[model samples]
Target: MNQIRPLIPLLVTAGILIGGNGLQGTFISLRALQEGFSPSVIGLVGTGYNLGFAIGCVYITRVIRSIGHIRAFSALAAIASAASISMVLLIDPFFWFLMRLIQGICFAGLFATVESWLNARVTNATRARTLSVYRFVDLGSVTLAQYLIPTVGIDGFQLFAIISMALTLSLVPISFADRSSPEPPDAVRFNVKTLWQISPLATVGCIVVGLTNSVFRSLGPVYAQGIGMSIAAIATFMSVGIFAGVVLQYPLGHYSDKLDRRKIILVATLGSLAAGVFIAFVAGDSTLLNYAGIFFFGAFAMPLYSLCSAHANDHAKEGQHALVSAGTLFFWSIGAVIGPLFASFMLDIFGPHALFIYMAAVLALFLAYTVQRMTVREGVPAEKRTMSFRNLLRTSTFFNKLATPPSEDKPENK
Candidate 1:
């Protein structure tokens, strides 16, 4: 526990920042719906944020290096707080999209700062413990913060004000926590072709996840509201789906280690496909069925990124996990930018049920690709695999570094 003592302030900052960010996302979607924006327009807003997030992933490291970590973090937090409250200033869809874009950039920088600092602080011995603690804080904060929407009610200034205040308060903990800044994060070399050559299944799987999961986070609330759910029920619906992913991540990752990781990816893809079908066709207007379907959907779908990361790591050369991670995230961001726009268009045309249909279609294609790959190539031998499975969140490249155990072989000192 002593090793984790210094990280408390960082963890606390994560909880605060994530809680506010989580709440603001759902709140914005619900508010947009209430204001009579079409599903397609609302989806465009999601796309804008994701696009900005992708931009940040590519460039934030440079900013951190240039200005230093603490200053970068404080600036990002302040801008995010400003963006959160700015939503009320104008009710335009385009305006909201712009604000979300700024928020995405700010948040990407903020997470990069915190995660890189944490990565710099830990040794290999304490890596797993720190990861577990950080994961718990991230998941717990996001899950509980869903209720903030219903608590403040999304129709007024209270929720936005709360989001702003939360972002502002996040500044307090980290500002005082460490007097000296940690080293800047390593810049990600985003060579998509190289990552594709390393592991195509993992590459495609990350994209599929981005295509599907971003829709759920960005538009799930809109779907719930369309189906006549109460505001509180909407919160429960989103929370239930997110929290359920924890139940299956570890077990599936453990089994993947024992066998070909692609086989595990196939299982998860099938499960996600099945759940999407159930939600789209069978659930209909039944609240109970919707909740149950999403519960299973989240259980299967949320772990795909982590599984793909593990599978890619199994094949990555020494010193290349960071590159693999950055490449996969780049692909995932591409999907995130496109998914909501496409899904929302379908929602407008065919109604909210189209959301799951789109997801199921994407998963079905990914499943077929997985099967084809397994046939074409042999699996990595169990003895040759290097990295163990660790749960991952799509935060930053530095987070991936911390999750990966250091390679065992010593340097030759060239």
Candidate 2:
């Protein structure tokens, strides 16, 4: 507790920043829908965020390195706050899409700055524990942020103002902190060919996850709204799914360490597929059925990225874990960019329920691929498994530093 005490301000900042971003995400979707934006345009707006995020992942480190963390964070926070309020000024889909793109880049830089600073504060002994606390912060903040939509009501400018305030307020704690800024994180590397060569299954798993999960995150509100759910119900629906993801991550990760990680990936993907099917065909307009289906859906689908990361690290050489982590995100971002656009088209053609059908189809294909990989190659020997399972957050490359297990050959600061 004493060791973590000094970092409390940063954690508070993280919570505020993450909460604001979370609210902004759901709000944008619902607002766009209310404005009578076509499903395709909504999807494009989501894609814009993902695309900008990927770009930031590749380049934001340089900004931190050049200007240092504190200034970079302040700038990013200001930009993010501006971007949040900018949406209310112009309700045009294209304008919102552009704002979302800017929001994405700013938030990406914000996360990279915060996470890398956290990494600097902890020693190897405290890394995992600190990460666990940070993950809890993330989970709690994002889940609670959903309720803000219902409380404020998404019709007017209040939600956007609240989001802007949250982002702006995040800067206060950090500005007053006693500690000096941490060193900048290493530049993100995307060694695609090498990552695929090391673990094709892990690569494919990330892409599959990106495709299916991004849809749910970006379009699930649309699904809920389309099904005649109220604003509060939509919040509950999204929150339940996210909460379920946090609940199931540890147990799934524990089992993956004992056996082949691919098996756990397969199990998670199958669960997501089943839940998707239940939501699409069985739930209909029954709120109870929808809630139950989303709970199961999130439980299985949310942990696949960590599972895949663990599997990939099992094959990675000593210092290659960072590269593997960055590469995994690269592929995932690729899928994320494409997923919403395609899913929106599906929603346009088939209606709200088709959202799950599209997700289920993707999961089914990934499930088959996982099975085939199992047949082709034997599981990693327990003695050879260099890394254990850690919940891989898609925040930044430096975030992966906490996720990497302490191996015999300590990785040098990349």
Candidate 3:
């Protein structure tokens, strides 16, 4: 039963993550369309979500650490459910922005609880498989969102509301069913600054991942619209990229596990660099080429965060995994907040190609930073190597969790 108990919570959490947050990326666009927001303003709204998400990650961990996983998990779910409804009821951009911030915080808290729960349950033997299962749920849920949006119509916030509610409700059973785990420690105390000092490449890698990911999510549609692609073309562009990333995770991860993990970074970064060039040179001219380009981009680009996390984990203290995970999330959210606003401005100034250009530039810097790490290149200890998990889980679900900050009522490290 203990073996299966882990499976239950894991599956339930996966369902909640996919059903809830996965729908949101497309849903925001649909809602923005209905609300008539300008591209720049739409980007700002996304920025607000990132700002809120960062706060949630830092604070929400503390909440779970202090309150016990069960209670904190329930509170987060309820908050998210209510926040989703509130955003629908209060449809004005200003009000929705406010609600999105609230939702960001709540969603972050819930995500932290679930991530912590997964870590708490599994021993070393199961960590890889657990991560794989989690990834599958993550991707499966989000991919479902692309299809769901057209079915419901972009203007139908109510259906999105139903989807959000269903996701939140899924958590209730998992929250109650799992025997209460011990609270997260008070100080999984590797200083963020210290961690950055140890692995500047990894630190900057998190930022890059955040920058490219949010930029794509917030502005991908804008590019499709500007290029005069059909709606199906737009969806295909986004979906195929996501699928390519999903398929690439295991092969890449296995390779990373077997070799110098940093080499994998170099390889992925270079591949992303090539994909960016493909985007810059050809995507604007042919929709099929654009689709193929973004697909390659996803294959190389999307896994950066997981790779960053794994790299950091390679150097982490035993109890520090959650802290490091959340920290990477914090940095990622920081990037996320800035990503869209910059991309939107560039889009307005230069047109759709700026989106690809923005992505290309970010990858260039990531490659440069990784190359700059001579010490890492020369003598990274074999035992300390960080092997990133297979991209099997859509771990982006955890990004929402990062939005929560340290809750005032709880300990700091949580």
Candidate 4:
């Protein structure tokens, strides 16, 4: 506990970011639905933010390095706040895309800054626990945000304004925290192709993670509405599903830590595959079943990327954690850019149900490939696997700046 005292401000900052960010695109989706935008336009509206988010993650590190953490974060936060409010007023789809792009950049920059701070605060002693705590806070806040959106009533520009205010409020904790000074400026660097060489498994894992997770994040609510769930139900359904994942990540992480990380990835992919089939077939019109099945989905689906990330780190050369992390984010962005468009197009043609069809197929293929790999290569025995997430669960104080620096440029992780 003493070791993490300096991190309180960082944790609070995360709380605000997650809580606010957790709202994700609820306001946009809601308003678009209310305005009677076509399904495809709505998908684009949501996808636009993610597009920006990926771009922001890629470059925010450099922007921060050129200035400093506080200034960079402050700029991003202020801009995001303005953009959020502007979005509420500017209802045109094209303009929304522009706003979303800027908002994405700001959101990603804020996340990058926070992640870098978290990394700087850690040493070897408490790495896993810290990561667990930080991730829990993140996912927990996501669940809360999902729940909170229904209260905003989802019909007007008001919700967008609320998000704007929330983003502005986020600046307070970070700016006024009791911490004495910000860390020194950092120059960011990471190479995607290089990381791919170091760990192809991890690189592919990152892209797969991005593809599935962003699909749900961007389109789940829209999917719910298409399936005949109401607005409030959509909020609850989405939050519950996400909360299930939130609750399960620690156990899953612990379990993965004990085995060949690839095995854990394989299992998770299989679970997602099952969930996809269930949604496509068994989960017909029964909201309760949707909620329950979504819980299981979240359980297996949510943490796959983080698992891959940690796995990659385990095999990484010294000080490559951040570099690998950035590489992972790069692949993630690639997947994010592709997943929603493809899913949305399918929704446009085969129907909304096709969304899950695509998911099921993708995950199923991944599971097959992972299984084939394990069979061909020698792997650790199943019994030898053990992960300690159980002890690390529930009781969390928290804290990575996710930009990940490389050894050559920063001497951290290049």
Best model number under lDDT: 1
lDDT of 3 at 69: 74
Off by over 4 Å in 3: 123-128, 179-190, 258-260, 313-323, 375-377, 381-414
Evaluate residue 84 in candidate 2 and report its C-alpha lDDT on the 0 to 100 scale: 86
Model 4, span 1-414: residue lDDT tens: 777666667777877877787685765776777777766777677678778877786677678667877888788888988888887676788887788889887888887677667666666565555666776786677777876677768766767776777787777777765454456445545688778766777788778877787788777877888889977898888787777776656667777767777877888888878988898789977899888877788788877877776666655665565576567777777787788777877887777678788888888877877777667655544453221222211110111332222222244532
- The lDDT per prediction is 0.89, 0.88, 0.68, 0.71
Q: Find the 10 residues in a row with the least total lDDT in model 1.
A: 405-414
Q: Which whole-number lDDT from 0 to 100 does residue 215 have in model 3?
A: 80
What tens-digit string does per-residue lDDT give for candidate 2 at 162-269?
A: 988999899998886656777667777789998998999999989988898888889999999999999999999999998899878989999999988888898999
Tens-place lDDT per residue, model 1, 2-85, is: 888888888899889888878877888999998999999999999888998999999999999999999999999999999989
Residue pairs in collision within model 1: none
lDDT score at residue 165, model 4, on the 0-100 scale? 78
Q: Provide the lowest-lDDT 10-residue window in model 4.
A: 390-399
TM-score of each: 0.97, 0.97, 0.84, 0.87
Give the C-alpha miss distance for residue 199 in model 2, angstroms: 0.9
